[model samples]
Target: MIFGKKRFPGAVADFEKAVRAQDGDAAQEAFARLHRAAAKAGDGELREAGPRLATLLPSVPHGPRAAVAVVIGACVERGADVSACAPGILAGARETFALAADFCARWADTGGGELPDPDDELTEEIIERAGYEPAVGWFTLPQWEMASVAVLNDPAVRRESAGTAELLALVERVAEASDHEFRCLAYALRVLDDEPLVVLHRDTGTGYALRMSGIGDNFQLHTLLAGVLIGGKHLPGQAPSPQEIAVCRDAPGQVETVGSFNLVGPDGTWIFNEGTPTDIPVIDGARLLVLDPPPYRRAWPAGRFFPGMRGDLVLDRVLDAAETAAWFAKVQPAKR
Candidate 1:
């Protein structure tokens, strides 16, 4: 519309200018405008701008990179072909914008639900050779169990037993590597036989939890948290189910039940309570609360929703506030 170019093109120009100026705030605002412009642009305009927008991703500042990636994801969601952006996205898979990059990659791969049939001739041949019948649609329970056990028992997989000391060391390493931007709180739960539970509270106000079950070594720990940080899932585990709480006001009685949690990564697997709620010892824990940042900031969308309970379900009313706070005060920081 301006200078013979459409709104999208104009917005792209503004974004490019902001990037050139190395202005983080301006870049963020420009990216937002670009997203709006893309939404209003026609399908033809989107297709034409897709590749150009992708090329700008690498030049975006770290603080605003995720925002830019979201714009690209929006374009892809609108049916724009931005497959060319995959390489840059994969390059930054470990960076802060990982979740958005993952969303873009997934959208490109599935075209938002058009995936290739998994039960093709090659798959059937492999199934026959493995002495397993080809499943018509989904994996049967027995098949799934067998596969899971096989993966668990694989020789290449790495597993380690970690105690309190090793856990502290791992947390310190992750914090140092992320320059303390990756803030989280760890707790040692007595109910789970003293397993360490890590709750990552991001600057975006999004939170995620991982229970360290003395599984894999530090590398696995990094990978697990990294996937969680970006709101993506590179592992498999049981999804979280709601727990039932009972209250009897007249009788002045209350019953608390055990909840389930699981995480399976390349190196290790963790299963807690097996997705069932049962009567057990009261759930009490000492806090290893490390960094507590204000819970208000940018909103980052998860590329793949990890199977876990909401923060309130995982923590609220379960832990004694006074006791936990006292324990947190007594805890010392892990030595570097």
Candidate 2:
């Protein structure tokens, strides 16, 4: 039941007024000002909550203040009415909807749905109706609450899709990586193997080409389409354009994508002109894995301009420091 109020007055109030009203420039400015208040005492909750809620609202449904306050309380101590807040969390952030739905539905608690049998086509029907189908009716039914139920209950997704060649081999290798309960694009990380992979798809004037980086750690090239990246951008916050979104669809019957890369060795390097397989060194050792697509054949280079996005730069930064790797690999691993 928390309400958002104008904490700042005077000219600040007037500016905030414009911002909340959806005045683009003012909204951006207001966001900055509000962001500063995020860390202050009694403000930390709202501060953290605002950004997350911004993503959820208009897509899910709920208030930001109430949601953040509940999360804050949950983080500090127990006995919080999380079930009450679960809907708010889901209502606000789509990225968290799966988890949030699990929470509000009280999946793990006593009197919870626990899980339904796989033959439960009822759950499948719910998913079909609610999951990415071109309408919003599913979110309104009991289905949204049970969405994650079908997700974890279905043994099919966990068993892994098999029986292809090159890409399939690469995907199976992903099994070697860390395991987290995967879902939707989050599962993409398992194949792509990391947090979100950032790609650059700029208009290279030759139509448009794409390239991603994760080289030395992953000895494979992630050739992708501009549409894939752009598609993810349409999720309510940003409209991923050809420049922002790049396609990484799987090739055939296999669910593996072209941009998928699994760590095979340390010599991961980009090969320019596949005509001869030239080595493009992993940017910053292995911190950068580059994905370069074939040239777009339009407007001279007028098809797709391949803009290379900085893939997991963290690994490159890590690989750059031999000492850091040694410390963790030797010093830490022995203790564990």
Candidate 3:
């Protein structure tokens, strides 16, 4: 009967009532409606509603807790201050739904307090013990999703089929010219393609491609790619020489060098000591060539990279030339 009625406050009240009564069905319906209402609400309204909904978390039924957490996550995405909700969110995390807990933890404000190192490990163990399914659809999370769709749509990110063919031919020629089968790890940042990719080559003819969309920055991307090459058994017949291991082990912690490498284009333009592979411009047919020792020693912490988690790296598949070209062609890059 009321004209221009505000939906957020009313929705919040209904949600709180459902939680208080521990009515799972009603809570679910209420949360869905609340989520829709939240989408329409202004930032100021969301900021006000966030703390109110957080207070109801302790009373929320276990069955509906994850749904509530999702709502809270949306609130945080819209500039809501829900720092007061950390204790309740962490509590629910300890109780159940570890996957959802991990998602919610990103939004929780810790007041500049670091989690005790041992307790942090114990919590990770508990989450592992929960046996949650692997997280997928990483692009759904705001943080994981590319900040600028315009960047992803840029034409420079797309490589022409002719360029890809040339790159394959170049790899073949290099392999034929070399003594050992060509093998190395390479990374490509095609922002228009949505995810940055790391290709691990056991041999020149074939390679495994992993989507590293979850990597936070270029530095993390370099570090993780290096870690995977070193720690993993990607090099089949070739074992790292003792000198190679010693060099990696003795390298200074903050050294910027990612070993000796050449950055080349399919057209034969080459540069040396320019920077890490990641620093290369996003041009069609550009490549980073690491022709030195095979990576077979651990140079970074193992636990830093989370496989199959949201906003973390996930293995895509093994790809040869044609398959790789097909994958690249699937997404149409934005034209200039």
Candidate 4:
């Protein structure tokens, strides 16, 4: 060890030993040691050691991949020319993100964390140009939907530059942190809201088609819910009438076949695509209807994830809930 601290090489060597023995705890400890060492080391020292470090990244467990990438992100942040190490970093990132996608898919019925195919020509092109600012659109997002999700969940990140370093920073922050699954959806929603892709088609007069590219049937319903909630609040004029809200709720079903959405009206519940116009009777003084995602089925669910949760309250609760759930699940046994 150098100066009574485990230096980069020694830390990496310890990680390798942990990996060889398949000891996850030991591997994490070694990676922590390596991270601390990298932090203490200078830019030139990291840049000089880049090649070997990049090569070792893919071999490590997925849990530590972003932590390893953090070193690279920091190097890039500090303006180190990582051109020689970029290829290796990209290759490892592809593998790690794929593993992350699969891991997250296990939590939710529909969200597999959808990373783009790394082998695709367009993906390679984006990665090639990732050294530039425009790389924000494709490389960071398509590579891992979680990055998109993270961007959406955190308004700060969504509003900032979603460049390579920022994307890497998000992955590092979330991967081994907490609320792995919920945060992914929360973050993705923030990204989706800011994303230029969601074209609002007011063709139906009251409703709009939320055409977001990466969003599939799984997310289509949630996207629709988000659209209605967002649109109701920020429709630029008066709050949408109950009739307008009813139409918007039904719109997603016509567009996507997989999921169904509905709104609880003043008179009764109105099922999307199932009821006639007369069945969804209008109320003179009805507020925008509240709908919940499937399986939860909670009545008048206030926000996306919790009840009585307005703007700032919603953000805090959802984030705190997700983080708490993540921590709880880890310590307690699974229940039926």
Candidate 5:
């Protein structure tokens, strides 16, 4: 157990004390100190509490969850023998209430639950592959789940009113696309709530708008644009291969062709402003694509405000990069 009854109770006690003090600033400071100590604990008493800490994580609220996640991440970062605890840590961080509820209930019954057998060998591989970092790991789990849940709740895209199957598929596809699955999930989450979409570039002379989706998810824009550029005459579900994506990206402006650009619904209903017609095949479910520019342009000048959380400056940083575009394209659905 990482933080059993007999070990490292002082750290947990100090954290709980600060939390009960009702002073947000002091609690934040306490969390910071806890993280520092956990990171430096190495193979000391705090390190010994790893397994217990994993099961203990889910029973707490958001603030302590953040602190505990940091401690677990620090253990993983330092290559500690936390193999027995990783699954619980991940489940706690992710709020798998079905799995964690029993752990929490049991903790309430007896100060700690039975330590699960260590699977550190496999869990360590998963953590390393996901690039777990103490700084971001804690925040990423809940945030990523939030983003995925929002997409499922979106009426236009929901496969069913419940949307559970669609949500799981979304998570799986996103993980497959990203080198760091958790990091990608957090990025996806932020864009859903905070950065929906914005016109990153506009033509002053023509009054045309070129918008990009905020964060890369199934509805990401870059892949659709690349598919249009390379697979011009194909219809109904042809996506660009990586090599083809590269070709389209290398010269995006040059690939602009005769067909209209669109953001379409699952039913083929247009979401974005309509564009010009052409020989390009209409992909019935294409969510975000560009063949031609949008008819309306932003009234404001370039670099002007968009009346949202993110500024044009932030959009510029994300949209203008080839690597970002590549990553975004990977997360988007191949067909729609």
Candidate 6:
């Protein structure tokens, strides 16, 4: 009971007491004490104290989690300069994110599980929706995907980094934080437009295979979506096409499979594929057509888990819209 504050064994210690306490009052009191302690202590200087403070609060049911989010959100709202508050706010937010990730892993389909799998960290749905399969026999996305998603979802992070001159800084931060090559994210956001992989058969008038390596197993795929431009060079003896999907052999000895893609038309409707085979041929010196990833379908209708959302939940909603899809599919004369 140093200075009227009883330090617990660990973060788990405080959390368990909160969970097991017979009365809500005891838990609330413990949480308030811990939250204040953590906030006042700032960060890094506290040794293991940070985890201990984080664990004591009611993370679920929106009590402590909401409080932490509120505090960080307040810092942003109060015009806290990026130089002063950004690091601590990001640290606090990361702590909260860790807690939430733990909470999510403890529950199974019914929302109770011990912890999220360090392995099997991704779902087939994410893969299909994102338009590229994980490396052979792998699950979850690579580091670059995680970085991209985080940047897209967090408004504060984006607001701070949004600028004309700081593009290189933004890319460097993404590379450092995501454990991926800065060039990878840059290509995805700018030239490639986040389609995972793209294919083209134009430049050399033959099929060209661009292999992606490093960060994990090698993956090869291709696409040209709206506003995305790529040089279509083909492999030897392979003809080029303006409106066709290219199926390529992965590495060696691996069976070739057609990748599912979405062709979003200007109209509200969408075109999708299940990776079934098509008997399309190629011609020389014509337009180039990309095999975009397929449109998303809601496994459980929206508002089931995500409230106020109608239809299905698409990860990249704005970029995935039918208008965007159609524009990408629309044939335009290649810029000379």
Global lDDT of each candidate: 0.35, 0.28, 0.40, 0.39, 0.36, 0.30
Worst 10 residues of 4 by lDDT: 307-316
**Candidate 2 C-alpha lDDT tens digits along 37-67:** 4333244443334334333334322222223
Q: Model 5, range 8-30, lDDT digits (tens) per residue?
A: 45565565566565555665665
Query: Is 1 or 5 the stronger prediction by lDDT?
Result: 5
Query: Model 3, stretches more than 4 Å misplaced?
Result: 1-5, 23-26, 97-336
Candidate 1 local lDDT, residue 207 = 30
User: What TM-score do all the candidates reach, one by one?
Assistant: 0.29, 0.22, 0.33, 0.30, 0.28, 0.24
How many Å off is the CA of 257 in candidate 1?
31
- Candidates 4 and 5 compared: the better one by lDDT is 4
lDDT at 255, model 4: 28
Q: Which candidate ranks first by TM-score, i.e. highest?
A: 3
User: How many collisions between residues are there in candidate 3?
Assistant: 3
The runs of at least 3 residues in candidate 6 whose Cα sits more than 4 Å from the true structure, single-residue gaps closed, are 1-23, 37-42, 45-196, 201-336
Better of 3 and 5 by lDDT: 3
- Give the lDDT of residue 235 in candidate 6: 28
Weakest lDDT window of 10 consecutive positions for candidate 3: 143-152
Candidate 4 clash pair list: 149-187, 149-188, 152-187, 152-190, 152-191, 153-186, 153-187
Maximum-lDDT candidate: 3
| Model 3 residue 300 lDDT score | 31
lDDT of 4: 0.39
lDDT of 1 by residue, 1-336 (tens): 342236677778788888888787887777777777665777666656655667887786443454555555445444555345433432332232222223323434443443223223325543343223222111221122121222222112113212323333443443342233111112210112223443322122223333433222222222233333322332232212112211110112223322112222112222122211111111234222222221233122121111111111122222244544443444343222
What value of lDDT does candidate 1 attain over all alpha carbons? Answer: 0.35
Per-residue lDDT tens digits for candidate 6, residues 104-170, read: 3222233332322324544554334322221111222122223232232223343344341234344
Those runs of model 4 whose alpha carbons end farther than 4 Å from true positions after fitting are 1-6, 12-27, 79-81, 96-336
Q: Candidate 4 residues 236-275, lDDT tens each? A: 3223334333323332112212222334333334334322
Q: What's the CA error at residue 321 for candidate 1, in Å? A: 65
